[model samples]
Target: MVQENNNKGNQISRRSFLTTGATAAAGFMIVPRHVLGGKGYTAPSDRLRVAGIGVGGKGESDIAEFAKGPADIVVLCDVHDSRAANSVKRFPKAKYYKDYREMLDKEHKNIDAVSVSTPDHNHAVQAMAAMQLGKHVYVQKPLTHDIYEARKLTEAAKKYKVVTQMGNQGASGDGVRQLMEWYNAGLIGDVHTVYCWTNRPVWPQGIPWPTEKAEVPKDLDWNLWLGTAPQKDYVNKLVPFNWRGWWDYGTGALGDMGCHIVEPPFRVLGLGYPTSAEASVGSVYVDEFKQGYFPDSCPPSSHVIMNFQGKSGDIKLHWMDGGIQPARPEELGPNERMGDGGNGAIFIGTKGKMMCGTYGMYPSLLPSSRNKEVNVAKTIARVPEGHYVQWVNACIAGYGKKELSAPFEIAGPLTETILMGNLAIRSYDVRKPKASGNGFDYPGRYIKLLWDGPNMKITNFEDANQFVKRNYRDGFTLGA
Candidate 1:
């Protein structure tokens, strides 16, 4: 039987953790490392060739970090040339493309890996196509635009047997590893609930649809940006970075940051599919448009509660965006801060708690209990340092895969946790409400979403489930 972890430590002690790193510094045990399956798998003598799709914003960072590592970036692909210019500058040796498909067909063999940092909607398509070409993939999170997409990507990675990683960089952080170790050592017992929040909703909130059509920018190929998304006229509000708040291109605040913020310990603790999901949100066109711009793509803000009936008990994940936070856990240090602009997660265990700021595994909090100290497992060690180096070393020397800090298999579900939030948020725009009064299910809501991991289909709520799955513009496979 699964036992839940309570925050009541039997004993207390004062100890300052001193470690070289989590993977392997001084004392921690390092898991066995192996190159990708296949006998003749020789390390790359030529810089592992790369191509980057959706080459702007976070994509730039993804490219820069890899190029900065022991790799040679050979191709840059983005729908908008102007947005991709800086990335092109970083990889002067690489060719550029507005259409990623053409880039793949032409440079397929020449490329060993591809970084997919496109909007949520394009991630599954780009990453899956790259993997089918026998290329390694690094796609940004929420791994896919929706839940079924996440499952599809997972299956593709497994079948293709390519080394894959998600772009939730927190998966590579020092504190993230440490948090995992604490869980592995049974510090938090069997954790049943997690509360994660982010301060988003700045770009796309309660604002209404654009009053005028936005002319396509000179350098951008608008058709490509709408990849697989239903056709729509280009609007400035939908371009560059503001796409997160839209339905066709993004998954609102939850989809925007869930991959980074909610994923830290969820990955560490192994939070599989959530059983039941319900929401209470304030959207972009909500309340007749009060807060911000109401882009058709996203909601204003939401406070969603999901209950997953795990083997142990019910694990409730509380998610909020738009300047909201659960009351700070009793375990936080006095120095820790909360409020607007802070983007991170707080893992409230049965006894003590762990908290993180914008950086995922960074700025983590420990208790400052004078009366009683929170006890952690003596064998639990700190996380390995340099999340960036971890992935680099793993890719180059083939050292980190067996225990990839944030392998796509794990992070996908965590990102899906956020996708559920998208469902909750977007439900506000449901032509027919899910509930009749006060956001409760309609007098007799017929939809019962039963998510089976490997299958990824809702046994009940057939129509509602399909709505959650969404229809892609032709040519987009839901992965497997």
Candidate 2:
């Protein structure tokens, strides 16, 4: 998706600033200096009041970072009280709740923005709720669990007229802009092929669900944690982390790091949606003889090829996970590391190649020495305040008054591109009974699935379409 430049010629008036400020500081006031006799009077108009959902771990850090700017942590929500302890301790004055639904319903008027750093499954619901309340939202990466959710949230951002930003901090980094400038400067000419690899799924995957159920933590509301996912008993090590391996909760290694890894090429090339997708996955053997069948779990490893119709020509992007790295370019020295050791990306243009580490960090020309020789003019502005604070400033500046690095307008398509890889990975295991009623036939395997991007479908494969939009459990909706 091409983002419209909403910042052009738009200015924030003092009246609009105060109006937005009052909404953020609703039910509370920043004492004016006139009342206290000239100590200081920072206008509440200068601040943004933010409520955080899933305020633990990454969420904890997200809230803390937002607090570093002109923003206040007014409310916090998380399913597990134990996980939320540090944030609760740090923002003691902030009200705490276990259910995000209740927290937003009660506190929406008091906060101008919502920060969501929850699991992949809950991201859409939580973010959509906040946006529906006319509040700006900052969501963690991958944006949503399914393609449909990403599309809905993207549209809702514009519909609600809210400021939206995804939590892929790399989109705001200097490295990506540098890569963009180099590409724009023709240092790398017309990238037709791209490779993005990651050493991830550091969590368990490609295994059957544990038959045994663990007791729910005393502090955790298991039902709330499940959210839109199917009803199920709690499993050990599924909370605080490790949910990434499950199909119901996480988007696997591709989703875990794709936004950060694939973003550089996507932005530098101005990519839209992929026209086709095909993937091959690494399998796990149950014993010594038979391969395991765990459709609910993500594969141990995968390599997906996505074909996008770029502006200049067709661009083929390759996504590899679980320690799979592409062949080193001829220009790169054998001793030189590829993409920060374990994770990185490489772009192959007609004239040359360039690579970067994860989060678009440490970008360099293929020869590595060429980086020192090239002096491209910096065309893109850098986010010195970093990603989290950028959102806070944008929220304070009001909607469309300032530009964001990963606004939903841009992030939605990037997320769809990432999830498209997952769709292929999931479809890789799709099976059907053979005519003889024999073992099985995996039709989705080794076949290029044609994509109808705007319609969100795999035209050639009917079974693969099942994953395009998931059915949420009862009592949950996208709420768009």
Candidate 3:
């Protein structure tokens, strides 16, 4: 059975924390070297004790990365035994559980931090619960499944006074830092437009929900796996992946790759919640005569345009997915690859344009020749430990002791900005009965949505607002 952690001794009291340094010092738990055994011995207090939820696939890799640093992987939790098997075998001494709540209830006293790498829908709740217990959190990219959840996690990071980091590893990459330095140097000359594209939905999309149900795998705790999402019977081939196309469990292509592809621009431009959002989606024809209307699944392809108020003036950002891409910049050579061929982003400024591949890799000038001619002095310090190790060290350093690359303060707005596109895409499919009652009218189509960032509302489009926050299943809640 699941249990709430209320033990005072296990919880860190709420307090205001302001981190200033980049160094990851062990969080106020320093011990004399002689106290342990010898000069070369490291004290247990210096290591961060971490518990991992969703210990499979990316989660397994995330935990392993943390283990590579001064962190001890002590507890492992996942809804499926088969998925957790590899991690369990690797971290043989670590305790294992299928439910995260039970693990936290019993092991909170031993854990100093938590790593959350579950599906997008479960990210917020798991991270929130860990934070409320005073354990620092390192959550996977896109932060949360919904805009409201992202906003709340941002606020909670401050209210709970816990160190937090998002798993958009590119935020910690040298490439993004290079882009920042160039932008700060005025090389790009005020980026007014940006285009990010991806060839995603490598899995199925724009398809109907499976009508047939399959027997639940014995190794899987189906109910727990469905945490926070509406209850539904088991479906084949949706376990490890393919959930990205569904609104109920995943955030589609934008959510899957947006954090990695759009992050460089967000960092370089200091972008926040968009002022307005609009989108156009490509449709899939079910048969020779009918267009497919799978409202529950993402479109085959989509192009979303969002308007943001930048430092100088208005900025327009475009997001493309499902193999769609923007026109090639004129400065590039005919044989030159754009954005690593499959995924990339281009920033267009007053003077020039720059582009980068996914995860902000391989940032370069439009002509590619300028990269050799012009050199900007590096201003931002790189994280030598990389994204995962950096988080582990920061957790040991405690809240307010060290700064993080993608803390919720920055990640929240970035996530909300990226998800704004999804909101517009979902809103586009809103169907309503016509006054004559003969057929449906697509009122949400071909319209720009006005967004109130502070209030998290679409002022002009009432129907679009529904996508901002979704209802959770009865057993789950994003607790304060």
Candidate 4:
């Protein structure tokens, strides 16, 4: 038989549980029902109770992976009911909520961990809220939209003593370990330059917003979906995937694929923050005769150059998106793929070069013969169960008990480095009216923006500082 709390007079509502001290002083223990055998005791369970914030698209896959591990999907929340339908069906016993705030307020005590897979803009606030309640969090790639948010989350993870992992699964793969081993063994002697390229933004970009407002889907909560962004009418095709091309919601190609493609070089080189950054974006042609720039949307393509100070020396990393790729190495055969064909990263060092594809797959030395001749002992341990299982186990083991590959301490700086490239991209669009009143003068072009990483600011270009931290809409904040 299970014990029950019969003290109705002392019972406190879930909303007031975290705030009220009376419940604690009155000798009322807020233990889960399963652990009611005694006070200050926890029932040993192999499962971790998890609540998913964005249960659709990548969120759906994230939850699915967690379910395969030691997690029990207890609650599902999404602004769009239709988008969350599959996850709800997969975990029918889980309660559902449209708003994350309501779910956290009522279910915080019940949930042991949270998986945040929402848009880039809302990630920080939602993850912060969960961390504030002492819940472990696994947020998707490009941890936060702004640099300041990344810094805050990194600090909070330590302050709150909660386990955290970013959803850049490549960090857990064996390929990266191989690269690290090769680097450590001096196969590629002191890397000085790197190139990471991606062919993303398959959706619409460099276009004007829809002129007409569309009716909000009956099953969708528009306000909740636009959590931190300014209120705007719902637009067709933006809900599920197309949001990546907009500055208001996504971090463009860099945010979408940077973590997967850049993680290898960042990890192998042991980089901190970028010291300077610059970029050149592809222009959009409105017609056969006229070219224009869209400040609200990400350009169709871009090439960002960021400099990082490494222990060996200064490292220069070039990021190319929208199908742009670096020149092929002359030592390779003509038929050999430059980096898994379309998306990959290359490291240029003093002695030789090495490259790999997205997710750190297919790492190889410059010449095909060198890869076969060189074999370095593995120095880094591989995550056998992969990234998702790694996080689930880490959360269960408690903070500081298990090592996470992409903890906020690591992922935060990686995300900040990736987003720093976007600052240069956005700054390239800063314009002022021309003196002759004919066109606009672009002041941000042809200038390298010096970065002060610790302070999260652009020292050379003051206009670029606006993007370091964004002003959140009312009712949403990076919680303290």
lDDT sort, best first: 2, 4, 3, 1
Candidate 2: 10-residue stretch with minimal lDDT: 1-10
Listed per model in order, the count of residue pairs whose N, CA or C atoms clash below 3 Å is 20, 0, 1, 0
Q: Looking at candidate 3, what is the lDDT of residue 196?
A: 97
lDDT of 4 at 447: 86
Is candidate 1 or 3 superior in TM-score? Answer: 3
Q: After superposition, how far is residue 272 of candidate 2 from its true place, in Å?
A: 0.5
Candidate 1 local lDDT, 167-229, one digit each (tens): 777666666665666666655566667778888866855555576888888888877788888
lDDT of 4 by residue, 1-480 (tens): 001112111222322454463344447655453445556443434467889999999999999999888678999999999899999999999999999999999988778889999999999999999988888899999999999999999998988878899999999998888889999998889999999999887988878788888888899889999999988888988888898899999999999999999999999999999999988888877777567677778889999999999999999999999989999888779999988888999999999989999999998998878988997887788899889989877776667768889999999999999999998888743366554342443455578999999999889878888899999999998885
Error of 2 at 228 (Å): 0.2
Estimate the overall C-alpha local distance difference test score of candidate 3: 0.85
**Model 3 lDDT per residue over 1-480, tens place:** 011123222221111111222222335533344665677665565678889999999999999999898888999999989988999999999999988889988999888889999988899989988988877889998899999999999998888777789999999999999989988999889899999999997998988899999998999998998999998998989988988888898998999999999999998998888999898888787777566656778888999999999999999999999999999999989999998999999999999999999999999997999999997887789999999888776666566767799999999999999888999888743366555332434455579999999999999889888889989888778885
lDDT of 3 at 47: 72
Provide C-alpha RMSD values for all models, in order: 11.4, 4.4, 5.0, 6.3
Candidate 1 Cα RMSD after full superposition onto the native fold (Å): 11.4
The deviation in Å at residue 303 for candidate 3 is 0.3
Runs of candidate 1 exceeding 4 Å displacement: 1-46, 184-188, 283-295, 331-335, 339-341, 362-366, 370-385, 396-402, 428-454, 458-460, 475-480
Q: Which ten residues in a row have the lowest lDDT in candidate 3?
A: 9-18
Clashes of 2: 0
